[model samples]
Target: MIALAMVDNFPSSPGIYLMKSAEGSILYIGKARNLKKRVRQYVLGSGDSRLHIRFMVQLVESVEYIVTDTEKEALILENTLIKQHHPKYNINLRDDKTYFSLRMDMKEPYPRLTLVRKVPSDGARYFGPYASATSAKEVLKQLYKVFPLRHYPLATCMARKRPCLYYQIKQCSAPCCGKITAAEYATLAEGAALFLEGKNTEIARIYRAKMNLASQDMRYEDAARYRDLLRAIEVTVERQKMVARGGDSDVFGLYRQGDQVQMAVLHVRGGALTGSRTFLFDWEMETEEGLASFLNEYYDMDTPIPPQILTPLPIPEPAALEELLSEKSGRKVTIAVPQRGPKLEMVKLAEKNAQTAAEERLAKESSSATLLSELADKLHLPAPPRRIECYDISNIQGEMAVGSRVVFIEGKADKSLYRRYRIKGVLQSDDFAMMREVLSRRFRAESDEEKPDLIVVDGGLGQLSVLNAVLEELEVEGVEAAGLAKSRTFRDMESPEISKSDERVFRPGRKNAISLRQNSAPLLLLARIRDEAHRFAVTYHKAVRSKVMVTSELEGVPGIAGKRKKALLVHFGSLKAVKEATVEQLSAAPGMTAKAAKALWEHLHEKQQA
Candidate 1:
């Protein structure tokens, strides 16, 4: 009744709406062309049969809205709110890996191309949001082969006295040592830019002209270089199928089953299929709304937008979306639902890819679910543990001790929740003490709502007892705990007996260790979790140890104090580099005077000699 009253007051204009729970937490966020009409559908339950909508409607206690002059503004506002609040009922897309882009600021005196995740709006030409960092790096490698632009850091190049290996290998123009003039470097940069832009014919023409001029001047070496460049360009064009058949565009295909959705985007550049990106979302919404929300969020201002976008389903408010995209891309943009021809074919291809990816993902998820069920049964857990936290400690003779906590949700690692701790309370190599300290600190930091269903420690009954004591002291209830340890075999001293490997699980209140069957799913899952925790702890321990060693090594030098050590490390990059540096280089480093540099150099060399 209250929801209907709130809907009655909604304005009949395009805007964003927020559905809140009793405690005012946002349950869902949505955008609409007509706020009043949209809100009424949810409040009255008029023809909206989606399972999630029915569920969300039951939780929505109050409603709020922000009126906008246009649907595009509402769309933008909805995306921002969804990200900020992470509404429980919205289709949330969490992509941890950001694609890489090749960025180069042409305004710089000696422009160098570099890979970056974010594209700054500082007049730099950005080439890609490549499918992966490796793909972007491969493109950079190819560019280096054809264009000898500077590849080293600008500061390093400026400070260097001679050309490095890249220059010697003809992969760099060596602007640091003046091997190439500014004008010549600019020409190379332009050629590289054109090549990335898929203007291969223009680049080939320029290379051919350069080859002719070099031959006419009787510079056979230069002519041969240009010939090779032309050949590389020709091969790349043929391989990419860049035949000037189609303009730049992006095709989006969507697949949905129950609450699971998958989206695939195909990027076409210069009539050639360049790359594709796949995204998965787990939520329910109308197809048009889902597609609209995705389109608005995926193509942010910083992301490169193609001139034309093809969608499997027609998006709501095409004109408004087109206008917003045009403003973002700085050109006219079109959003179309193709019915026939090559554009339709591209859409079909994207849909096919999406469907295949969805199937694989579902199969993997089903296997994970089965494994979780099996594990719960083996452990005699009250329910299948959705989130399991594993703890491990790593140290070498009680020095540089560290502990790691790894989280797994439904048999998949949730890396965002993983944590590391320095074993400050325990100075000695006591696994029991280390486990207690780590668990106490971890539970103290996390709220009850964030607690894991199960806690796994790496050890035998001793470690399990420590963890159980800590949990009891903290009064943390409703959580199960266990420890994993390698089984030991006993043999008679006077008689020989066959031996076998045994894996054991130690649980609280159990008089004897639980023996798991060999190659069982539950045993394997627990072993994998324990190994991952150990690996994380060891990695963190090594990093901490390295820092300690570097600090200690620098402190041995008479005049190198903490500040000087930091400055030296920051400038020279490492302790080994500082040790290998000459007196002049050391003096040039920040915070180091000539006298101090000489003294430090002598002290390091003396220590090495001794």
Candidate 2:
């Protein structure tokens, strides 16, 4: 346990503190204006009523602290450390998908717009972190219709003898072939950048003047092109409803159900609702502190920080957070909890989104729980198995043998707990031995508490026997085992005598398999788990096979060393892409000389011809 003496010894200054468990893992991280006072409250068991904190305090073996010049600095450090360590007792944002932004370095001679996940500090203009790649691409498509900026890479464009299809379709200016001068292409690139930045009025003005000048010069085609560009910009602006009513700001709303917390952020850029993001976490901290911490972490340098931030809950130390944001953004920033009017309405809308998201999550969890309960009853289990692990083996002719273990928690796949193993001890296509080896290795490494309540193998009686044998040898107790096997032929509904045993579930010591009801929830759940394990194993096996193929193919080419092969793969994304690349593109790749590129190209095509 953390000693009171250590708490007393903490410095009386603004800083962050880390509560570490006996196993040396960080349990919680917090920032305080006075480190000594904050640590004392937890050590003395006073003013810390949070249930999670009480549990964390019992496990804390030591308290570590770092002093900072100000509370703002301490907040920054706290966010960084929390993200780095991901302490158990703290709320951490974990999202499966990251939004993307459109990026272009305007300084480039013929700038090409591209999609990027992060907004870097390099001198380049960034458009957004659009909710999906499709949305970002849609915007790019619209911009291309108007801007006609260069679309090819610098090397490809410079090396090409003729313009590609994009140029023929007037989607690019073809700066590489000198169809458009560098200065003219730069002007077009700037217009595209301006449109992405939501400066539609300015771009429209430029286009209008160009159109009128072209018309006066008797260039009807040029005038028509400029008119179409101006029209596209105006239509896009109207569709997005871009206006400068409330300036740029972000509104945050939070909802909580027990320990579950959901936050919704609505991004209002130039007074238009651009996009929103939702974050879900399990936290036990006070609402104000949680909101403050989330804001500190969410608005890092890479994320565009607006002038105003509206939160439904009043943040603790709002002034300090505002100061920190202002310092980071190089502008005045306001953190407000609006009580009434339009701003308040925005907060309420955000809150509604958070509540809806939470409800959907709870509904899904409830359904999963119901399915798990049904499955448990059908399997004659004492209770619903919270964790079910299913295993499968995949290989072709004993080559690249691999096994997969997929996990399901309350009937929902818990992919994080899934594991894979290469069949190291077994040779040839013996599924029984492969299953035995995999189970032995897995059970030996897992602790008693981490053991699954039920284990499933992706085969019938043979696989079940292997699983039971391994469990018995390991002396593992209180865990049930079963095997699932697919039926050979499709069921004939026309004949009543036809058995609808699409899936057969086998239990140890049971000579006959249990035929699951056709289209039953329990059967479907088992099928999903078994299929996931099979898919994982097959994917790994294929990856191993592909790597071997790539190695063999690369080895056949003389003078191509491992480093050069790696460079080629990294540049082209795969061996298939490398094979498809032209000699010019191959030569342009890093670590490739002209002669080597030609030789590699010839060798790849030669194999294809053979």
Candidate 3:
């Protein structure tokens, strides 16, 4: 450990300090206004009494610091370093995927609503970074019901001689079949954009005005359509709950039990509760520090920022945070801790939700622990396995073979530890060799991944034997291994109801496969894990297979490298579209030239005619 005297010589200015383990892995990162005083607190043994901090301190072998111009800079730098190194004690984000958003390209001949994960500057209108996928999909579903915009791309549907099912369902006006004029479709697209922006009231007002005008002109059919649209908008708006007086805001509530914290964020847009998000993680720092750090990291995600952010506790340098978020959002932003009134009630509501979420999580974990105990008993294991891994192999005639590994911690999937390996040394359809290769590579001495407490092979006796042999050859010890086999179909002539037997688990050295209760919790959990491994393997296998099949139709075209081929597929949506596109249209694919497009056009035509 570094001497306390070393902290004495450290700079007192605002900066971040990184605590490193003996192996040079950053164990924790912290920011402070006065660096020396903060490090001194840890080194002198008196700054905080949190349990994780004590554990972190025990592992600290050295310290390093970088001075910044101000506390705000220190905060930003601390977030950057923590994200890059993923320190052991930091409250990390649970998901790296950006929230879903709706994109509408007004420039298109017919604009269709599409869900996208990232927000890019493409001159099209974008709405929402919806944290809940269901909420986003529901929004689109409701939008399609109200506004009859095209459901598919213009090029894909324009050739249809008759309107599709969506047109019959009233979800599309069928611009492709000329059921709606270009002018009418433009109005629908504009209305859809406004509705996505949470402007239902505005939509109602405009539709009402149009309804009156249509009636006055004696256009009874048009008036009825406008009346129906207005009614739908009113119903939609009335269903939404108004949580604030005005303006967009995000309110945060937190529940903390020791180092574990569950935080809830309520998204209020246009004065109504639009959606919410919850986060569960461990934090070893003071509540204020954790909240501050979370705010920094959370806002840095491509999530949309609102004008105001309400928190349960005051964050350090609210102005700095506001400035950072404002610069990113291109708006004036404010942060506050409400003391009274409706805003305070909103915070309380968030807290109550957070409490409920935390309680539910605790109960679930408790149930999972019990199930694990039962599972251990079923397997004759010494203790309940805390880290379980299941592996499966996938291939079609040994073509583009792949292996998948899925991990479960405390009966929950830990996606970060999941892996998929491409089979390199195996040939032909030898499942045993595939299993052996996968298990050996997974347990190699240099792998940084943690070894599993239990290894489940997704097959019967042969797979179990392969797993055991690999463990023995690698000299790996203390891991439990089992093979899961599917239920066998049983044809009972007298009893048609008894169609299948229970799924069987094969154990090492056991002649008969043990059958757990078919619908029991332990068996269901195992089935879920096994299914995930199979799905992962199948997905990777398809990707490898597609890469092998993607070579056709474009192989002989000049300037059609891998990236260009992918661009063609993406730009045209499919190879069929690419085949049908004219030379000029083909040239429109990113980075494609007139000469290359012509070559591709002639090549496809020559093949098609031949």
Best by TM-score: 3
Candidate 2 accuracy as TM-score: 0.81
Give the alpha carbon lDDT tens digit for every residue of 1-610 in model 1.
2357768888999999888889999988988899899889877778468777788788878888999999879878888898899988676664546668899889988899989887656789988768888999998997898898888556556657788899888899899899888977887898999888888888888888988998999999879988888887787777775422567898899888887789999988767787898888866667887788778878763568889999998877788889988887778999999999888988999999999999998899899888888888888999889899999999998889999999998888889889999999988878788888888998784554488899998888888889999999999988899999965777777869956558889899997888778889899889999999999999999999999988777676667898998888778656766777789988998888998999999988887899
Give candidate 1 regions above 4 Å deviation: 2-10, 21-23, 37-62, 94-96, 141-151, 158-184, 236-238, 241-244, 378-382, 486-521, 549-610
Model 2, 435: alpha-carbon shift in Å?
3.7
Ranking by TM-score: 3, 1, 2
- In order, the Cα lDDT scores of the candidates are 0.84, 0.84, 0.86
Taking every candidate in turn, the Cα RMSD to the unseen true structure, in Å, is: 4.3, 4.6, 3.5
Model 3 C-alpha lDDT versus the unseen true structure: 0.86
Candidate 3 off by > 4 Å:
1-14, 17-28, 32-65, 94-97, 105-110, 120-124, 153-165, 174-183, 215-221, 492-498, 556-563, 580-584, 587-610
lDDT of 2 by residue, 349-405 (tens): 999999998899889989988888888888878888889999998999888899999
Error of 3 at 416 (Å): 2.5
